[model samples]
Target: MSQIFDFSGNEEFYHGGSIYSNPKEAGSFLSLGIVNHVDVYFPNKRARISAPLVPGGESLEQKKQVSLDVLPDECLYEILRRLPGDQERSSCASVSKRWLMLLSSIPSADLCNKFEVVAEEGDEIESDGFLTRSLEGKKATDVRLAAIAVGSGGRGGLGKLTIRGSNSVRGVTDLGLKAVARCCPSLKSVSLWNVSSVGDEGLVEIANGCHRLEKLDLCNCPSITNKALFAIAKNCPTLTSLSIEGCQYIGNEGVQAIGQFCPNLKSVTIKDCPLVGDQGVASLMSSASFVLTKLKLQGLNVTDLSLAVIGHYGKTVTDLVLANLQNVNEKGFWVMGNAQGLQHLRSFTISSCRGVTDVAVEAVGKGCPNLKQFVLKKCAFMSDNGLMSFAKAARSLESLQIEECHRITQIGFFGLLLNCGPKLKALTMSSCFGFKDMILGFPLPNKSAPLRSVTVSNCPGLGDMTLAMLAKLCPQLQCVNFHGLPYITDAGLLSLIESCDAGAGLVKVGLSGCVNVTDNVVIALAKYHGGTLEVLNLEGCGKVTDAGLVAIADDCLVLNELDVSKCAITDFGVATLARSKQLSLQILSLSGCSMLSDKCLPFLVKLGQSLMGMNLQNCNSISSSVIDMLVGRLFRCDILS
Candidate 1:
């Protein structure tokens, strides 16, 4: 008897006498089992055929798959040009050699246009460069630096490069910088922070290669010395801004080189450089006097002579900051003011300096006629007399900030406020222990001052009477912030807000840490200033409850930002806020409100529709899973849980 066998299924058939129909039978098959003549029919359409295995049992006719590499060069170039950032393009370049070449061939102008498009969509793009790259920590490898140097050649030439920290064993060296120097001639700004591996050799390479360098910021880079600055001074003539902080080896010589060679330098900030003394500062001031507009000297060993030179030669200087200069004396500050060369000075800030005395401050006020803003911090010797004298001298002064000034008593504080010109628009006072409600001798001004904002913080001596006095003095105040004032109550805040002129309404009010503030203040805000009030921060006001939030939701139609953290708010309050039709709040903070739980999740998710930022930190009662779900739903909102 003959049995027919079909090979259409590609199943193996054994030549045994008995039929072995099991397809699972394993072994090589020599022939079909008991088969006579068999005929096969063919279809009209072509069918895929399995090729016979080779000696190694691998198929020779493997299928091919399409990929980005297979695309045309022009197509790849367009794709790379549309990448959001250099890091993304760099990642794509690592895929293949063809991609790297295509990415490098992209024009700089096209990359710049892509950056502009990204910026318009609210993404941060470096202002100084059309292309920017940063290498940090372990990623700061010479190989990657070399790659950036080669890859960024065609993509608008790296506009800015930042190298921060490096690998512990082996990191970026002179070789990497040399590669960048050789390739990126259009480099404009370079920032090196805590990158100890890089020294003068690498910096000089950059200075020699990138002649268009405009800004250089070096912070805690101990390896850098004077030689690099000299090279930059000689080569980079268009250098406009230079900041050197904690670079101990960089001394007067480097600064002097910059002063002499970089005549177009507009801003110079030299901080904590022990070697920088009178000579370097004087040279920089005198040589670059024509165009220098801003100067900041902090933690330096310079003396009065430097200040004298600045006063004499800083004719074009408009902004000056002097901080932590123990070597500078009152004589130096007085002489600087007496020079009368700071005619164009607009803003001056002095902090943690022993030389800031009443005499020096009064002299500065008398000299800088055009000075518009003045800030003083941690000046232990500065008293009310100095403050009053300065206030009287600075006629163009529009803003003043005084912090940690212990000697500025209520007399001097009120005297300065009373003597200040109508141009004064903003005043900030913090940690002034001498401020008190006592105003018996000082007479209040009959007409409201033109001041638009006032911030008084941590002054325990300040009381209700002072707030009433300020309310009467600055009725047109649009912004008020009183924090850590234990003596201030609802009545004090009430007086300040109620005293606002009919035409002038409070736009921003902050009563943070004022435990005595209650829902009454919120009700008052919703009643009088609700139409114009846009920012209300009542954080740490334990007395505030759901009633306050309900009032805010009902009346504060144009409110844009509200902070009720650490208040006695519950789910009902959040639900009320979420259901409000008129409130289009963009930022909301309910951190530390222990009463909030998973039940408030739906309401918060509803509120997240209009919120750009929400802080739910320390709300331990709310489940993490709920927050995770809310995060997935609120794709547009930034939640900090």
Candidate 2:
């Protein structure tokens, strides 16, 4: 008997070109000793395929069609999870919408572990063993961030994330950060810049989730406050570096919490945070269980009390930078130095601080016995007496840089050179109005100074005599940079270079903006130090011509970087350089050389074999098409046209 079943209530079903609205119709089709099958798919449900028996109690044998769409969601997810690479999974997802949903459901942590396993098998992991991702402007959206939270797991764990300047309408908010926090537990460093949409909630989530975070930088994030910082202090115990800038809401309480909780903190930088005061600075310096090695405080409201605390408690500090502290006076620096706790300080920078006077300078020199590098800028009160005294007292100082110190005269400058220890290897002075070419009765140093680098720039008062004096004092100079000194003629530079020791050849020579410098200086440099010269900058020296370029090409075999912007060099010089078989030039800048045209493009292309970067801005004779052609030919070089 052919048992008939009713299918009238169900929707129309089709099989083998037959529409079977009821069981009787379906029975007729089945009566031919053929098994009829119907495949149905339901949304959010497992797919099912059913077949009915024939009248003779026999079932028709047929081949079943199988595909990813017909598979169960759990099965599909497992298949996607087992895929060895992100590219493979991505290819699968592109097939249909169902695969994409399944792929997104996989746990990112598991994917990260699987990726690590694969990396270990293939030996593809980098030495750092980390992945970095950045989101900026329109890209800083919750959907994209969520994708990163998931996709980054498949390649390698996300170790660093940077979010800069979010979209004004749909910027990254707590939701995006929360997604990151939920998935990327391996995150070690995070930087947020100008992201006003993210607030304390997002940061708190990160702090609670990424306990291994070692560095955090927040700049211009107005919404972040003490709450987020406090949360981080309590949760991120291994935090080693922290920088907060332009966050008005962050004050002493947040810093105090960090000082009290984060015992392993190594570096702290707080800039333009007006609310920070003495208590916060004191706590950060005195409350830390371990010695802080670096501290930078700028544009803060803290006074001398903070400096005193730092001087007393910062026994192991190696680097300290204090700038624009209007409230701090000479008394504070004097007291801090007199305390003598900066015995291990190696590098110290003071800029635009009223406290950097003669008294404070001498105190610092006498106090920091191990100080090796000192940089003073815009210290108007610092005169020759204090500089001379500092030179005499700082026996261990090896590098001194003075900028815009109008009170430092030629007498003090000479005294510094004479009194500073023989270990002083670098001296940089710029924009000092007090450095006048005055006759000095004191005898020059009896022996050649051990100074290897000297840079003097933009000092109208400095002249040929100053360079002559420098040449007499330091005969073993390896790097010389003189800029914007119109008085420095070829005679001065020639004297300096000729005095250099033969064995210690000049490695870098920069005479940019020295209008008085002509091809003679360049020719002298090529003849005397070209074999060892690696970097030569003659930018703005309009008097230089192709002769200098020819000399450099002929002699500077190892020269890798050369800048001759605004010079009088033509195609002849460029062609000469291109034909040089020995020149290993990597970086070339010919900006503002209007004389150069399409004629020089071929020559530059020839030189681009080993060149990594080139700049030809303002070369009007060369059209954009030619520049584009040059760029195409030199695919590996970065061209700034």
Best by TM-score: 2
Model 2 Cα shift for residue 47 (angstroms) = 16
Superposed model 1: Cα runs more than 4 Å off: 1-129
Model 2 TM-score on a 0 to 1 scale: 0.82
State residue 324's C-alpha deviation in candidate 1, in Å: 0.7
Assess each prediction's global lDDT (C-alpha) against the native.
Answer: 0.84, 0.84
lDDT of 2 by residue, 1-641 (tens): 23223333244433334345574765554333232133333222222333454345555333355454664564455556667776676577567656654565565444533434335457544213188999999988866676666566556578999999998888998878887776677788999999988999999988987888899999999999999999999999989999999999999999999989998899999999998999999988888725689999999998999888888888989999999999999999998898888889999999999888999999999989999999999998999999999998998989999999999888887788888886799999999988787667778757777789989888888888888888898888999888888888988889988989868799999999999899999999999998899999999999999999999989887899999999999999999999998998999999999888898878999999899999999988889999999988999999998
Give per-model TM-scores: 0.80, 0.82
Model 1, range 387-503, lDDT digits (tens) per residue? 888988888999999999999987886777788987999999999887767655656667767799999899999888888888888888989898988788989888987888647
Model 1 root mean square deviation, Cα atoms: 14.4
The lDDT of model 1 is 0.84
Q: TM-score of the candidate numbered 1? A: 0.80
